[model samples]
Target: MMIIKMDDNQKLGENDHRRLGQELDLFVFSDLVGAGLPLFTPRGTVLRDELLRFSEELQAKYGYQKVFIPHITKDELYKRSGHWDKFGEELFLVKSQETKDQMVLKPMNCPHHIQIYASKPRSYRELPIRYMESTVQYRDEKKGELAGLVRVRAISIDDAHVFCTLDQIEQEFTTIMNMIKEMYRVFDMKFRARLSFRDDSDAYIGDAADWEAAQRTIEEVTKKLDLHYDIAEGDAAFYGPKIDIMVTDSLGREWQCATEQLDFVMPKRFGLAYVDSDGSEKTPVMIHKALLGSFERFLSVYLEHTEGRFPLWLAPEQVRIIALKDDANILKMAKDVVKKAKEMGLRAELDDDNETVAKKILAADQMRV
Candidate 1:
């Protein structure tokens, strides 16, 4: 395990992304843009795009189709999903001027994704319908709760939903677990499972039989995967039981990074159904997934985890070619090298700045370029 030490900081010091973001010129915050929102620089956006593609690539392997949802939706949708009552003041309501439409910035993507799944009549053959979306969602957070990237009002969420039949629960769950496993393996992240099951609480918004059955399915799948997990009662989302992936960061602090929830509520709430073999109508089960949770928070954790020394594949500035002398011919040759590297799909750049070779080398070394 890598340990990072720093001075004069909050929970994160030298490894703090806020500190590193300034030093590395990755992102910036402005008073005009408000406190919680941040503007990602070209470099920071590279980090974001790279990580987003990585997750999407892995998800594509499981037949998960790309999806898009509006940042704002009609207030009635959340009211139907029960999120309006649950989230209450935490929601960012957008009032209409031209019409009587009361809109709110979406706090979650599952409800919208459910609308897509419920749009058409499905059959048993389309048992496991999967949809993936990497987008932003908004929430009205308290002033005291805001942080740099970890906690903010605007969140870049990598959210997905799987509408599958109850019989196909294990298969779909395993598929989602495999996706999580592959991501953790790629980042060399160690994680344990907290099977967030519901206690006998009224707050849990589903039938008791459905809750117990879903919990059993998760337990069986965990055993099948040979994963070391703990059952956490009352840790479930109001709508369902879930598997939360708790990863150990470089500071030895455990953060809940990913979640795969088994929901029997959302689909039913939206009146989603499919045709069974016997021509009976049935509601499909829902799996709400946040593969890396929030992108900003994940990047913050990853920034600390790697200490900003990103792997060759994950690095924003993979290579920096510097000339030995201030010779046009030498610089031209270096540019050619950079062109070849770029052709080879490497993030490469030529250091043609009016600086000494020694200074260039020192700067690149310090920047992890």
Candidate 2:
């Protein structure tokens, strides 16, 4: 076992994700790999994949389809999305070695997803076209913000977008809201909604009428669902209003996780449109929804929330057998149990070693396996 002594200032709890991640052999960060870049172990990768699959399957029930996008794109993509003007400093710029081509690691998936929608001339019949992708997004965050998974240079977002007409906006948004509620219910997270509306300031885009209509529609949903929420002006995105889901962690501290946003400006900027029944082109509204804003950040919060003692379904190892004796018969028995568990599709393991039973049990308890 690797042990490092800490000074007075460092106070990671017994089950802190950073501490547990190391002790549980989940992930590690090497100095050679640089800060904010984590290397996940086999077990850690399984945990991440399981969470992602769960999110995808849950969203699939709400008319969402999986869509894929590249990790890098040209700078013009962001410029057209208006992200260049706002977040250009945070992007990781890449220049071609053979040519003068310049590219950037995507800071957000909104622009790429828009391309999918605009690939073909859509019609009113396909009013709500929903697409989802669990992909990593890159941002060159400041050194001060670098930590375990809380703040990372590369993060996976369970992101989705729906292009719908003005009349279908409420229904599409409501579907996303229901999906968010179901996700939180599975995790047993206590949350409240924040209706983020524009202040009608010069910073916000789109017409005043569009912003007002969007805000009022979201308000109606919150009221219909009887959700507890507060209005926060000037909290909306530059192009739209949003409903931000705020979850309270085990320590009673609150953190924003999921968000469902309404955007009217980007579609217009991209010239994205659909044919109406009257045979005229009309701009479609884009809804940006992220159930888990950042998959890495969500794991960090969940690990701390459950203190590494996950329920059976989410636990890395559901059962661990420690042989009381080192005899051949006992070791074989333990191996057989593990084999049978595996055949039954269970995460089980046999602890066969020179260590004493008491020590093995202590180690298992520490891992919560």
Candidate 3:
């Protein structure tokens, strides 16, 4: 294989995603079509499907129910959740074609998940309900800050929401932490937890006591689990505190992976309540979580972390069956191998060229095929 070397100063470099993305034939951005959006090619589509599969397998083992929601929501929905008021500057709003009714692209999935919880009356027995989905979300990111897949306007998230009572909060959070650990472990990446708390900033919400309580809760949970973590102020959400996983890449850059936020306002605003064991109506505590955060962000992080050398488990083209001889028999065997590999759920392809074995390996390495 062709080995590439770099100087110490340029070591690991930027990973030059634009160049690599083109070489891999994954996705592209066009200024003519508008900025901050991407068009995924066939290979990119395959990669996204693999990511979805990874999320599904993990959710299944964690007893999460997969759910689908519409991309558009009524203006009132966001209004109730206070996103329209708080995040209006970053939202994309539209008027319905037929009814001229106001609608907006969903920026987050927690509001939708809360509506599902409020759809019907729930009992204390259903205290810890976890709903998961891999849905496309949007934001009006500044053009200047937008980059390839890493920073995009329209993105999909491996998001989930856990509705549980206060009594079950610690247990549920622990379970979600374990879920994040499993995801990181699968990618074989080392990670640290960041307890993101609100600072004395204008964007923070709730009282200082409330924020401290939430932060303390997460810190205590991590401590109890013996998970190593660092505390970061001013990294919290406007509505609550969160725990963000900071993973160090091969290049030693830290990226925020999984996130678990304890939200007290969204559920209250949406009027999400259930009958408690004591037979009193109580609001269910909502936990906003994403094991992989934004699929776009996670993929970009993983791509750089591995330096485009993805492990076989997540490699877009896991195997390339190339024919050593151009004879009919060899071609047929290559085709057969491709079919068998696909049937076994491996992402394999038949390279149909007369390139030497070494040359083919070098090409695959570059394309991350």
Measured over all alpha carbons after superposition, the RMSD of each candidate to the real structure, in angstroms, is 2.6, 2.5, 3.5
Query: lDDT of each prediction vs. the true structure?
Result: 0.88, 0.88, 0.83
Q: List the residue pairs that clash in candidate 2.
A: none
lDDT of 3: 0.83
- For residue 222, what is the lDDT in candidate 1? 95
C-alpha lDDT of residue 107 in model 3 = 90
Candidate 2, 155-224: lDDT as tens digits: 8889999999989987887788888889888888899999998885788767888888888888998898
TM-score between model 3 and native: 0.92
What TM-score do all the candidates reach, one by one?
0.94, 0.94, 0.92
- Please give the range of 10 consecutive residues that has the lowest summed lDDT in model 1: 1-10
The C-alpha stretches of model 2 lying farther than 4 A from their native spots are 1-10
How many angstroms is residue 7 displaced in model 2 relative to the true structure, after the best TM-score fit? Answer: 7.9
